[model samples]
Target: MGDNIHLDYKYLSSLFSSVESITFEQYIINQKIEHAKELMVYDEFSLSEIAFKMNYRSVA
Candidate 1:
């Protein structure tokens, strides 16, 4: 898993280097949505837990 993370980091760094510019808000939103999906599908954490982890004020 650590090796995978290293590879993923390299890939992301390459992507960022290639892109002329990036929006932090869009990136954060996309990551949060992906994480929310994972939390829902995996059922490893409750909605509130996921929301809190994502820095959301509420599940609503």
Candidate 2:
């Protein structure tokens, strides 16, 4: 919640006047997923830890 960069995620839907190819939410999700995959290289990080680190409410 506090650490999220896209804190105004919902409101951003109107800010983007162009770029209809992808929504901001989709972009953020993709970036987070890719980041999680990159973090997989480290042996110390568990899936739960990664989820929490990413500010996710659940590990789904």
Candidate 3:
């Protein structure tokens, strides 16, 4: 079951790599920030916990 839901990292890598004119790193950062904002609205977890879950070193 878990195996059926997995990230196609290779495909994503190829797609991101082909975007020659895009700021791909910034795109990823923006997406993460948006997700954090959404989670903050829910108020389920503390900011520090959310930042840790998102792999941040600290809740800046």
What are the per-residue Cα lDDT tens digits for candidate 1 across 1-60?
237556675567557656836554466678889989988999999999999998999999
List all candidate RMSDs to the true structure.
6.7, 5.7, 5.6
Give the alpha carbon lDDT tens digit for every residue of 1-60 in model 3: 124557576665566768854456767888889999988999998999899888889999
User: Where is model 3 more than 4 Å wrong at Cα?
Assistant: 1-22
The positional error of residue 58 in candidate 1, measured at the CA in angstroms, is: 0.3
Give the Å shift of residue 45 in candidate 1. Answer: 1.2
Best by lDDT: 3
* lDDT score at residue 36, model 2, on the 0-100 scale: 86
User: Distance (Å) between predicted and true CA of 46, model 3?
Assistant: 0.1
> What is the Cα-based lDDT of residue 27 in candidate 2?
76
Could you tell me which residue pairs clash in candidate 2?
Answer: none
Order of models, best lDDT first: 3, 1, 2
Which segments of model 1 are wrong by more than 4 Å? 1-22
